[model samples]
Target: MKIAVIGTGNVGGALARKWARAGHRVTLGVRNTTEFKGKELLDEKNISVAEIEEAVKKSDVILIAAVPQATADIVKLMGNVSGKVIIDAMNSVRTKPDGFNNSFEALKALATSAEIVKCFNSVGFNVMADTNFNETIADMYTAGTSERAKEVAKQLSIDAGFENCYNFGGDDKVALLEQFALSWINLAMMQGQGREMIFKLIKR
Candidate 1:
């Protein structure tokens, strides 16, 4: 699959590397990708990193791994995204209020032509690229209205190294995942995990 990752930061960098290493046609998207400092990463992974619009225009799946605060405006720049599979990998937490906002709303406002799926969310970057838990095994959770989109994401998850991706619910189920991330943060504060641990939906 042709994958375009929108962001050159940690989340985007890590995922892009893994996807490229997994042998998918990966494109790392950034505002000014040529000026990005992480060129060595893409070079090592043999992946192509380019401008946001160019990457999106050439891919089947467009993954948003950019900053939460800038999501709306950035998405606005990538207009007419209809019929594309948009992967929402951003956290829209409002620090002042100590809560969350809706990434879907921002996507909805800007991406009328896209089928949005929320995944790779709720978990940290390391855990995302490496889902090898002990026998208590974990599952990647994904949500999307389009069955095809979610299935595509499930395959991407598998390619990214996850063996089990739970088809938990539909697109609107994103809130539950966002709240789960918040809960993970709270527990991390208590257990000294510092968002380093991952939350997997394992069987009881």
Candidate 2:
């Protein structure tokens, strides 16, 4: 799969590396080609850097891990995204997009041509970097109305080393998913429980 990562921060960098190692073509979309948050990612095999518009044009899927407030601007830069899947990994914890409560809402409204889903926002970037704990891989959760987008997100989560990507339901559950991410943030950062811990589901 050719994936365009809109943000080269910790979360974006970690997932890019994982997918590159998994044999996927990962293009890092950045405002500046020479300097970005995760410039080192260019060293990884199957990973390269491109200007935002070009990157989006070359990829079939897009993973947005940018700041919540920058959602509108980012979507504007992504040319035409019809028939493409967009996986939003951003959360509105500290701030939100201009006219929306969360990144997912902003993307849904602005990136009208794309299939959007929310995933990879509930866990820390460290957890994303290494999903294994005592030989058990962590589980990921996603929510969106587009089944196509959800399926793409699930496969990308698996490519990033997660054990499974659970569907948390449809578009209405998007806000709830962000709240779930807040719960993880509260536990890991506020409660001092550490970022190494992760979430998984078990059934009989």
Candidate 3:
């Protein structure tokens, strides 16, 4: 799988390294090319770094790890990214009192000819990279309309070293954002435990 991971932040960096290690041809899409020069994990895992359009044009999956507000613009930049799967891993957290209607932008981005899946936005970079706990590793939850998109999400999760992943299903639901935020806040509150902890829903 040729994957393009935009945004050089923790999320993108982690995913880029993981997939590249998994033997996929991975390209990193960056706002600034110079920011990626010193990543030891990148080249070690056979990852190539490129500008936004180049990455999107040459990959099987385009993982949008940019700031939430920047998503649509990148989608426009990659105009007609049809027949490719788009995995959105952005988190929309506004400092302002009135929060953004986050799902609206994701829906708009899906306007591009692409299969969209909202995922990898729930957990921290540590968990995403190597999730191993006392019992079992964490599960990566994914929500997407297309079955193929969900399958890609699950495959990506497994390739990234997760023992389990759940396809939570559907497309562009506002409820997903609410669930993400609520989980994020709770995870944030667990200090000392730090960002390594993950939310794993289990049933008896």
Candidate 4:
């Protein structure tokens, strides 16, 4: 899949590297192509850099791992996103978009032409880099109204080395998913459990 990653920070950088290493063509979409957060990603095979609009113009999947407050600006630079799958990898627990509850809600309103979903926001970048844990692998979760978008996210999650990407229901569940991410934050940061921990769904 041709993917445009909007942010080059930890989460974005980690996922971009994983996707590129997995053979997916990845474009690091940033304000300045010459200097960005993950410029070293250019050294990786199958990864390149481009300005935001240009990157969005050339990719099939647009992954936004940017700050929640930048969601509106980023969507404006996405050009025409009709039929494009947009995975929102942001959390608004601390800071939200200018006029929306969260980045996902903002994207759903501003980028009406795109299939948007919430994912990759629940775990630390360390886990995203390496999902392996002896006999078990980590699981991912997604929430969105678009089935197509969710499926695309699931595939990308697996490509990034996850055990599974489970559906956490539809659009109504988006906020719930964010809170779920907070559960991880509370345990990892507040409770001193450490960032290396991950979530997994077990079946009987």
TM of each candidate vs. truth? 0.87, 0.98, 0.85, 0.98
Measured by TM-score, how close is model 3 to the native structure?
A: 0.85
lDDT of 1 by residue, 84-110 (tens): 899887776652111236776567656
lDDT of 3 by residue, 118-175 (tens): 7788888777777887867787888867788778989999999887677665765634
The better-scoring model by TM-score among 1 and 2 is: 2
Give the candidates in order of lDDT, highest first. 2, 4, 1, 3
Cα lDDT of candidate 3 equals 0.73
Looking at candidate 3, the ten consecutive residues that score lowest on lDDT are 95-104
Residue 162 C-alpha lDDT in model 4: 96
Name every residue pair that clashes in candidate 3. none
Which model, 1 or 3, shows the larger TM-score?
A: 1
Q: In angstroms, give how far residue 111 of model 3 lies from its true place.
A: 3.4
| lDDT measured at residue 119 in model 2 versus the true structure, 0 to 100 | 96
**lDDT accuracy of residue 197 in candidate 1:** 65
* Candidate 2 structure quality by residue, lDDT tens digits, 1-204: 999999999999999999999999999999999989999898898999999999999999999999999999998898999999999999898999987888898898899989999999989999899999999999999999999999999999998999999999999999999999998999989999988887678999
Model 4, position 113, has a per-residue lDDT of 89
By lDDT, the better pick of 1 and 3 is 1
Clashes of each: 2, 0, 0, 0
Cα lDDT over the full model 2: 0.94
Cα lDDT listed for each candidate: 0.74, 0.94, 0.73, 0.93
